[model samples]
Target chain A: MVEERMNTDKMWITMGPQHPFSHGLWTLRVHADGEIITDAEPEIGYLHRGWEKECENRTYAKIIPMADRLCYSASMTWSHVFCKVAEEALDIEVPERAQYLRVIADEICRIQSHLMWLAAVGTDLGNLTVFLWALREREFFLDLNIRLCGQRLTTNYPRIGGVRNDMPYYFERDCMRCVERFETVGLPEIMKLATDSSPFVGRMQGIKYLTAKDVANWGVTGPAMRGCGVDYDVRRDDPYDAYGEIDFEVPVLNKNNPKGGDAYDRFLVRLEEMYQSCEIIRQAFQKLQSIPKEAPSRVKVPRCIPAGTHMAKIEDPRGESIMYLVSDGTEKPWRLKVRSPIFVNVSSSKHMVDGVRIADVPAIMAMIDMCLGETDR
Target chain B: MTEEMIQAPSYEDVNKLISEKFGEKVVFRTSTKKNVKAINEKRRIFLSTDRDTILELCTYIHDVLNFEQATSVCAVDYIDRVQIVYHLTNYFTGIVIEITVDLPADDLHIPSVALIWEGANWHERETYELFGVIFDGHPKLERLLTPQSYEFFPFRKSYKLRGSE
Candidate 1:
């Protein structure tokens, strides 16, 4: 048997604006001293569509549809944040039932988004089975979204004061079924695949660690923060929509993170969060059943919200998503700013990928759940 | 037995503490009600200050007030002046504090908070290109969203392009 040794040659390597391992159209340029990464600089903006500037030109109603494309996998959450901001800015009220419906839509969106993330993680680690299974499971929720809003990925369901559409006729039954399958069957399988024996675990177990202090400094949030053993979640901390009325535990690094934070811990945090999303959806579904059949789902928004400045934040599946709006005394906005969580998350990569194996970079980046649509916006 | 409940310091209490401590350095402190109701932000306080006191104030915001991170930095052009906002939050206490400072269009420069908040690096760069608010002392202030060679303040109202009036 011949044993090969690592050759410590220094060179710069660029991992795509078009590499399979790269999340989106972002390039990660690495300084590789042999197989170890000495330094890395992440380059983004391949997906920048100037959605914020476009929002400046369009009326508030027009912007909701545009925001749906901001994070296509989790469109409801982005649209919901805008709706709340507009509602608050306009001083409009969303009825109790409408709020509850928004909660249901948002949670369903959360599960689907996380499943897509799970698939991406699996693909990054070269596990095609998990990727296939995760996406297969995601279809149930995607189909449900279509039934409710007439669109799947970019539903554009959330309007200014409330949701645009009501729950479909059999949505109650369909949601319960999807929730049961994802919780009981789909999640357990993913866990087995992730936690069970695989050579990939050695690559992910103790690599690309981010300390709690580093996470706080970089404003990292969502599963990445939870995986680092700092248990803070915006849903519980800053309750929006029907979150105040719901009950769910924010999952953290329940595992012994001797590495402070690891790719596997992020994997576990996301897996556990899926179960919690199921719990929230179940509770919201029960509350949703009691609403009157003919209750109005959306209110009439004025062409322009009263001239004011307001900032709204929500716990996106990725992290803390913020939309700050300043309305002039006109139909169009004076200014609109979107603080993309992934942009900040990706910025921390120049530090994270430092001193890591060049091989481990893909797995490390995957754990952060990079979606360039929002980051580049 | 009923428990003697402990409550975190109220927003007004924090506001008063800030007022007494910072005094006139604060250009204004927003009322606790509107600030709190802004997304049910229980621990956040909004304050505006001038550029001269910004670096000193951000040091106070970081070292004294214990803001863990600056989540976002953006500049809004009001035609007359560009008002930049830094949204800082403390994770442990679940408190968010928004710091605002204005720069006139004629002199659009403010001391960088990037020195305090590492996450402000890309944000400051983006704001520089888009709104032309130079973050003085920012180690590498270049175009983030736009190309490196590009030099237009696209987010500013004055930079009108070919398409629209």
Candidate 2:
């Protein structure tokens, strides 16, 4: 007797929407051949809240909170980007001292953001110890953030033309202390735990390789592009804030390093980047200290922005975050468009995860360091 | 090449080239603010070139005028017409070129420049999906970022959330 064969074409596996490691409300429908991902489709909009449409309806000042929700982890970056674009649209000049303070806040946010990325990436790689250590270091910066802005994550601390609040009395000392601690104890421990682990290195070293050409072609930026041998950093290339006046190196892979463009290179690059961010914060703190104790934190501008379009790009921890603001001489902006780095970075996932095993999917996605909130927004 | 051999083309030279080549097909031209002092002479030429002449203009901009990267594509709806703006930037020299096309609101169609720059593929798909502008001869002209079954174009000015429209 011949037995009828059951259908065994393509197996659909649900990955997220409730998974512990998943960043936000996103689901992955994977078509696999044993362990190989033949086709992968991302099902998004589960977390979508019509933020763009909401921005159009709300006043410019009211949109700040919504901007914070764009990338919850790097909330300051979103607020900074929004304020900068609004300032440009309004043609308002930020004070030199205010710019320096903005840099301090921006760098602190970067440190915290990279720490969060490191922790999340570590957690994804099964190195729970690294996650705890990284988060511990991250909390240092978050504490500083809370002290300054009265909130931990969504600190709507930036406003058009300047910051919402002046630097607190303990700002300089606190930032310097954080930097000293990061250099002396925090970063080294993270390096030892993450880089020295055999399984972590083996899991990340040569996996999901993206070339410099691919990086440019896909418009991938930040650490992911830098991981693949691209020397472009928006901070260095397109200077904003006091980044132009400051002295900090844009860390890329050493030319002599054999495995220059891979997951290992990216890990090393971010490791070095944390150090660079520390140096920037220290310099900014010193600058802040040297400035007069009483300087106006906010700039005076007309209520309505000049009738035109303006675009501003800033180097967020994730990548080059761009804000395009269109104002028609109204209290509210005519249009506000955000070119989020994660949106561009995540678009290259199909190219990155083609031949990799199913087990490697999480690691690859983490390397891209996508924030679905930003992407969907 | 010597410094004289690589003489930087003035903004007028670039503007003159577009006018001389495209003539009547060109619609508008304007200059915008740029960052660098060295490229102060640079101008952001906003041209509404013909759909058939897009590849030719893109090639001319790349090979001759030397705009290296296709920076961004912005789609705007103006009630009766949909305007698609291609913001192109010269990588080596920081010159921005804004190429625009206005299609009627009823049947918004333009030729796809995916053949010229592969980066235009996704941007075009996004524009098509959001503004209902069809790119003729696109490889995979389907909805991206938005779900396939999404009935209305969200970016359109007429598109309301639930009850407003």
Candidate 3:
């Protein structure tokens, strides 16, 4: 004889598709028992734009613009990645001076991108002051981008085998000023607002803890993996562009070290990464200043790639972005496959959200910092 | 973790090993244009065998050749035949190997490698749904990343898009 059990009530809460804090158009169907979430299911494809199909229709030159949309914040990086792979398939060598300029533009983009993430994360946490401060500081980097490429977000600065244009005489000086300001004034205030605040620390610390083993197993990269204490940074491991020539450190948080992998660890990593990016920019800027301003920044692209396949991997701010190019000896590629890092990083969201409070979801998701454009591309 | 431990095997060694490991079953070998000197050199190997040997080849690749990660699994459709391409990469060595099996367009069936590498689960499902390739032994073989009610295999050359149709 079995005794009858009482049916505990369960409430369904939907957070996304239009929510301000939610990343892109993802809808979270979470089952809650009282205040705690018992189960959660992520519903995607709300922001799918069929970029892959679109790529097949466009020429190689035209596809760079679409790559810009994939990760809008990191437009130059994606464009560079796409163009680099295309160039590799064509066996075209990018000029040394052009590579330096590319590095400068990419580093500037990284600085602005991390600033945007900081602002968004702060805004999600209801810290309007920090958001304003971050955006204010970010304007400096945006100005530099405007000076270099004439656009802020979708510059399409990177071209196949080179850049769209050369930098102005004032570019180096202006970039140096931005880096100096970031180090001396901007970063300290942002750090104080984020890490020093008890409320922010309480909301972030120990929440969404991903082990290093799990990070590698799932092919996770970038800050998400660094947040799990994995010291694997693609720039250091697989150098491309001017990264091999530049001097910068790969910031990691080990349990034995001062910083342990957590939301705070991720925050700390990005903070340090900004400084390293600045250092890279300084080196690249110095290199660029030495080169003649009249030097050609664009390469003459061949009509068709050799009949074969070529794959190139670059460390974008997100993670390891692999672009696979297959040419059937035609002007257009037979098949082009982009192995986006956000796709792999976004897969770890399930691990991050487990056992965390419902309110902290926004913070955790923001900390993961996945660009839906890259994920769905 | 050390570079010396991760030996960068030449293309000749790779071909010889494949020939030795699976004597008659081994079909042909082709080289990819992309080569990473520091990492494992990239190569594409084509295997012609029955459906039964699919699992055995995958096992041998994973267990012996040390193709630890399954990068992607995609199917390409030709006029009369379909080909399933398994793109595998070794993490430490950075070597990429493509194993392809050709099948008739009428009967596009191949065994799944999901049991060996869990990452292949979604990829195989995607291939199955998009190319209409049937995987014989895929656990929980369901449509992934696509709508449940999606009627047509959109990826196949024969399946035309809205404008083309």
Candidate 4:
């Protein structure tokens, strides 16, 4: 009976498999009653290349590059997770120097990714300043990546047990300089743009809130949870790599956000995270210096990984990423499973966007930092 | 290796507490065979429970143990039977407890934990499409990461690879 009373024009509209606001290839079929969204359904797989299935065909070492392709914005961390899993599965001990180096690479990737995300978020909200300014700083780190790893985006840098190369000559000075600029100059400007403008704050502040309960129930992690004032970071809690030795604070919402984590708090979280990432790298560089000069950068890994089921989780800039692997006593894995954070993060949008204006959809969606490369994988 | 005595700081306590609290409901509990004390504490816990008891167990884990998120739902095809594994974690403690519910080939159905963890929704759908496991209570158990019209379970062992005969 209610169905009969509904407006004839009320129907499900496909937002995008190719919408400008969509960061990647995915569609959102939102059921709306005029401009108010009654329901939202996210559809992914437009970019699905079957990364997990493909991993079965590749050797243990060969899959490192494949891992990088999962999330290009933060490729180092994805590959780092795989390397950590493979290392644990093989029972190989990574040297202290290598662990410190891996921390340096992963934290640098984290900052670059957050900047790229801030840039993408800026572009979505029609704020060109954030977009340009964020990337301007982002390029600095990208170049530092080239200096450190010889590639820009998909750096197949971290080998199974250790890094491919040690800190290059002048790496410390160059990296510290980038760190200082990001903390002192680059981040302040972005935060100012986020804070100063009424239009930006008007759109971002109060609406599209996901509560702490929702973050927990949705398995949301990274900036998404911290935005809601729930402090959780795998670097500190799980302490993989040199995160145990590193001292840093997990930043949360200082905006007195009562509606849980809104788009703005998540924004603040990422901004502060960029600062924290710098601190980690700065301390790690000092630790890197204390290590003996003759330390080996790469450790020897066996040609084949033994048969076993293994799981490892890492805090990606997007969220908590976990990989489940089953090896069949061979060079190739029997089954490889990726628990991409974007997949779960996107799913919760159904609840996230409800009761909001149709126009606010893009604003809410982009804040979760959707990387469909990881999601569809 | 220069660093010795890697600290895992009592992850085993979580497993022990869960078993003591929900022993009758749990079907099986096991950890990593890696056995190196440092690695052992970071060991993955595999808990088995029947379809009837899964929802209850999930509620216990989420409500009581504070494993706030259902990180991923993994389905594995073992030829004769399929195993549906739910990796749940307490972000505060980094305590990961993976709950597995095995379904025979004839009955590829299990109760969905989506009711407990909203994050499990898409994960269950992805597992459903790739491994052919039916998540009975999932509100929308649709295929993700594949063409909507694609009919094959490509991740299953039955799917012939290009190099295979």
Which residue pairs show backbone clashes in model 3? none
Locate the minimum summed-lDDT window of 10 residues in model 1 chain A: A1-10
Q: State the DockQ of every prediction.
A: 0.45, 0.26, 0.23, 0.48
Go through the candidates in order and give the clash count of each.
0, 0, 0, 1
For candidate 3, the docking band is incorrect
If both were scored by TM-score, which would come out higher, candidate 1 or candidate 2? Answer: 1
Model 2 per-residue lDDT tens digits across residues A169-237: 877777788889899899998899888999988988788777665565566778877777766676765
What C-alpha lDDT do the candidate models reach, one value each? 0.81, 0.75, 0.73, 0.82
| Model 2 chain A: lowest-lDDT 10 consecutive positions | A1-10
Using lDDT as the measure, name the better of candidate 3 and candidate 4: 4
Shift in Å, residue A292, candidate 2: 2.2
Q: What C-alpha lDDT does candidate 1 achieve relative to the native structure?
A: 0.81
Give lDDT tens digits, candidate 2, residues B30-79. 43444322224343456777667777787777667655456566676768
Candidate 1 off by > 4 Å: A1-9, A254-259, B1-10, B31-41, B161-163
DockQ, prediction 3:
0.23
DockQ of 2: 0.26
Q: Is candidate 1 or candidate 4 better by DockQ?
A: 4
| Arranged by lDDT, best first | 4, 1, 2, 3
TM-score for the first chain in candidate 2 comes to 0.94
TM-score for each candidate, following the candidate numbering = 0.94, 0.88, 0.85, 0.93
